[model samples]
Structure formats: structure tokens, C-alpha cells
Target: MSETISPAQFHRAPGVTDWRVTGTGPQAVFAARSLGEASGLVAPVVAAAERFGVRPDVDVRPEAVVVRVPPGPDGIPAAATDFAAAVSQAAHELGMTPDPSRVQSVGLYVAQHSAADARPFFVAALGYEELGDTDAVDPLRCGPQLAFNPITGDVPSRGRTHLDVFVPADQAPARVEAALAAGGRLVDDSYAPAWWSLASPENHGVDIASWTDTTD
Candidate 1:
């Protein structure tokens, strides 16, 4: 395995213009004409992974092909940059447009301040494994990763669990605008470009977050 690198470093590498650093790691989206066109990318993606000895997650949609390269325990490995570039090249060869706007990570956060231990219950119920100190992840990659945050139990208004949308810095504002127009109200934008906590019409909590300073 190559040395681990920061998100900014990976983003600045050549041929990664179509990629973004999500909550997990480097990911890219390519617009396709149809599912058939999207499916064509899988073979090339797998070949790239095999060449680099790293496994990448590929999701084919009717209009897009999303690829996520899982990071190492510490951070993204330098090898991922080359792998990402290969994927981007393959996408262009197929006449697909690189669309970084659609790349984002949707994670769940469970704020527990009660006395009883809830991690065990969640582990068994959700079939998750411990991911660092305050997070649980599905080994099968079936669902979004869940984070356990420390918060005051007295604040019922803050809610226990919330959806976190980790998107590219360049696309954060647009995403927030679309959500607000969808009937959700902004709870807090003090963190602007970093994150925005919003609430649905029913008061369900959701946050749009970004880590990169800019998309450059």
C-alpha cells in the first residue's frame, strides 16, 4: 500500500478534476446516456483496481456511474490518485461527462447522551463494525456510515439522530439552496461552506457538510 495522503493533496493531483473528497474518500460521478452505458464502466473500473491492487465501489445508475475508492485506515492512499485518474480516463473514452456535483456522502449521526450503553444495541441491530472511536460502519457497504456524537440529553429540540450530507465545497451552496426550496428550513448556516444544519417540514434534522476549502 502507498503512503496515506490528505484530501486536498489527492484533489490537486492530475486527472482527478472529476473527483471530490467525500466523507469516505475520493469519489467521482460520470453522466451516462443510460444504464447500459453506465454498466460499461464497471469492467474498466475493476481493471483499474486490479492493476493497482485496490478495490473500488462502483454504482451504476440510469443516468450516471458513481465510483468510490475506499480509503485506508488513516486516510487516502497515494495509489488512489492513479486509480481515480484511470477511471476518469475510461469515462471520457466512453463519451461520458464528468459530473462532480453529484458526488457526496450521506451518513447518519446518532447523538447519544443517555446513561445506558447503546453501541452494543446498534452493532447487533445494524450489523455494523466499530469504525474508530465514535463511528460504526457496515462492512458490506450496504448503508451509510453512522456516527455517535456526544450531546446534551436535555436538548430534545436537537434530536437524537440526523442525516449528514458531505458534499464537494463547490456544490455545497447549491445543495443547501435546493434543500431549502424543497420545504426544509435552515437551522444554522454559521458554518457556511463547512456545514449547514437544516430541518425538514416535520423537523427532521439534516446537515450539508464540506471539508475542502474550495474545489480548486
Candidate 2:
């Protein structure tokens, strides 16, 4: 069983908002209207983390900069609060916005006849290491987590590629509701407490997931 962080545990830190606390760490995304703005934030944020003796994993995309603070002795929430505050201050000074709603972690799904047969190919091709028996993850914590799902029967019309969007456990219900309200449909809830499958109007699949135990 993986360690799970609850909303209460995450929210205990003051001034930390919009950060999704996971088993590994706390993550947040800052939105940049332009690539230049996103680029500008990297140095200052990195410097700030270094000043605090923490190294954060940062991914700067064209529209956003995602930061994840790994768990330390001070703990993830504390470290994340410090990192997020630094980044938020830097972003504000640069006229950028911290969009907590955009904070999400994605996992890639590959439907295969047998995970045993397919896992090795992806592990070698992507230079990814195994996380569990069926999942391969980026050692650098940059790329999306890859999950190989066993498909024993004929392939579905929807295809093999699907995405898992991980959010805080407390936020899952609202996220699911928002998706359904936005013209999406529920595909399956049989995997609840782990994930809920949803399909877009175009039938593209996505799963809304929570890292914490949601079995209750």
C-alpha cells in the first residue's frame, strides 16, 4: 500500500492553496500567458528552492510551469508551501497567475493483450523504470506515469490511449461533477476509490483519480 495524503494533512500548511498533495509530493501549476513568461519563472523559482535547501522538479511548458516538491524531513506540505509561495511571488511580480485549478498529474494508459508481454517494450523504449508490476514511471519525475492495462478480449472502439488525471481525494467528486456538467459522460465507476472513467463528447477516455484512500 502506498502512502496517501489526506486533505486535512495537506491543508494544515498555511498559505498553501491549489496544491495537490500526493503520495510522493505536493504539486502545483502556474499558468503563463506566453512562453516567455513561463521561461522567466524557472530561474527565480529554482533559486528560491535552492536557497531553502530543497530541489524541486520543474517542468516549464509553453502555457504553464509545473512544480513538484519532493517529500523531505520537513514534509511535502511544508516544502511545497515554501516552494509555491516563492513561485507565486515571482509569478505575480511578472504578471503571471497561479492557476490551482490547472494542477493535475497525468498517467498514460496502454491496453495490451498481456501486460507481461508489453511492459518490457515500453520500459526499454522510453528508458522508464518500473514502479509496480504493471506501471513504468519516469525516474526524473518529469514524464507522465505509464500504466499497462490487460486487455484479454477484442479491442474497444475507443482505442488504447487514455489519460489518468490525478487530483486530491477531497476534490475528486467536484471534479467528476464538473466534467459531467461539461458534456462529458461517465464510462465506469467500478474502479472507484482508485479512479472513475469518463468519456468526452467525442468518446475519448480520461480517468479522474485520487491518490488517497477513497474506499469510504
Candidate 3:
């Protein structure tokens, strides 16, 4: 076993604690206060995740180093090096050399599912007005509104992500009924005088939470 060192013997590296990584897949990238101001590049980290398909497991620190991918034939030297080089160029544009060590992006993807007959529930029942439609990323609309996209496959096993939409203190029940009348199946009815959860038949769930200020 290697010998353990004490705090007095620790060495510090310059620019070590200065970056953040986020996201996964093709969208992976790094973020920092600024790039000259940044000590590294962003793309390689994304590339690493894309090629390796796994992110580093982190533990033991507020600022963690997550190696977003594992080494293998897919993440061979050539790809890794190329990704690093791309990161270098990106850094140069920002007035610095590449530091592949730091990369990440913050992003979220929500998959909305609905029936071919999804409109009335969103429009009439939910009291949501249609915003507009665009083909660039399929139709996206917001609702006092629950906008859904038609999907043709087995329903997902479980929801990986969910949103908690807090209703106005007095509007909770109305919102819940609107959801129900519109064919949104209800799954749970228990509440702690604070919040309740509702799930659609398809298992898309939402939590209606009550807001309370401390002065109470």
C-alpha cells in the first residue's frame, strides 16, 4: 500500500478548483466563470461521455471530478486525444489552451406523452391556452396547461424525472380536478395538509405542493 501523507505535506495545483461539468450525451460541456478566466476546454468532457457512455462516480467533495466516461475500445487514445484537441481549440478561441480536465453543461429534457386525442384535456379541462406550435423541436406549449406529445410505444416503466408545480394556496383542488376531468388519471390521494400527488393512468406524475412561509 502507498504511504499516507498528512495535511502539512499536501501540494496544491494551480487552477485546480475552478470549473463545473454538466449534462450527458451529445450535449455534454463545461462551464466556468469565463474561458480566459477559464483554465480548460469544454467539448472533450462531452466527447468523453458520448463515447464512453458513463460518467465518473463522484464522492468526498463539494467540487467533484466526474470522469464522464470509462476507457475502452470506444474511448481509445485517438478519440480521447481528438476530443482533447477540440477542447484545446475551443479554449484558444476563449484565449487559453485546452484543459480537457474540465467540461460540462446544464440541460434538461422532458418527454411528454399523450393520446392522439390530447387537445381537449389540455385546452378545455386544464384551462390552458395554446401558445403556438413549431416544428424545430416538435410542438411545445405551456399550460395552466399540460402539453403532451403523442407517443407510440410501451409506456415508460417509471418516470425518471418529475416536476412539482405548486398551486396558489387556494387553487390546488381546482387544478387537480381539471387534471382529472381531462383524463389525467389520479394515482395518490394522501396529503399531510401540505401537498398531494397525482399520477396519470400512464404513470406521468405530478406533485401539487402547498407553500408556507415561516412566519406562520
- For this target, which candidate reaches the highest TM-score against the unseen true structure? 1
Instruction: List residue ranges in candidate 3 displaced over 4 A.
Output: 1-159, 213-215
- Per-residue alpha-carbon lDDT of candidate 3 for residues 1-216, written as tens digits (9 for 90 to 100): 222221111112122222222112111123345433433333444554366343332211223222322222222222333343344345446554322333322211233443334454445644545433411111222122233444556365322434455433344567678878877866666763355667776876676544320002
Question: Which candidate wins on lDDT?
Answer: 1
Cα error, candidate 1, residue 160 (Å): 0.8
Model 3, residue pairs in steric clash:
21-104, 22-104, 22-105, 29-104, 30-103, 30-104, 35-38, 56-67
Per-residue C-alpha lDDT of model 1 across residues 27-118, encoded as one tens digit per residue: 89999999999999999999999998777888899999989988778788788989999999999999999888888888998887654445
Off by over 4 Å in 2: 1-8, 22-24, 70-78, 109-117, 148-162, 168-184, 190-194, 199-205, 211-216
lDDT of 3 at 108: 19
Model 3 residue 204 CA deviation in Å: 0.8
Task: Report lDDT (Cα) of residue 136, candidate 2.
Answer: 84
Error of 2 at 39 (Å): 3.0
- Model 2 steric clash pairs: none
Ranking by TM-score: 1, 2, 3
Q: How many backbone collisions does model 2 have?
A: 0
> What digit string (tens of lDDT, one per residue) describes model 2 on residues 176-215?
9999999999999997757799999999898898853222
Q: Candidate 2: lDDT over CA atoms?
A: 0.73
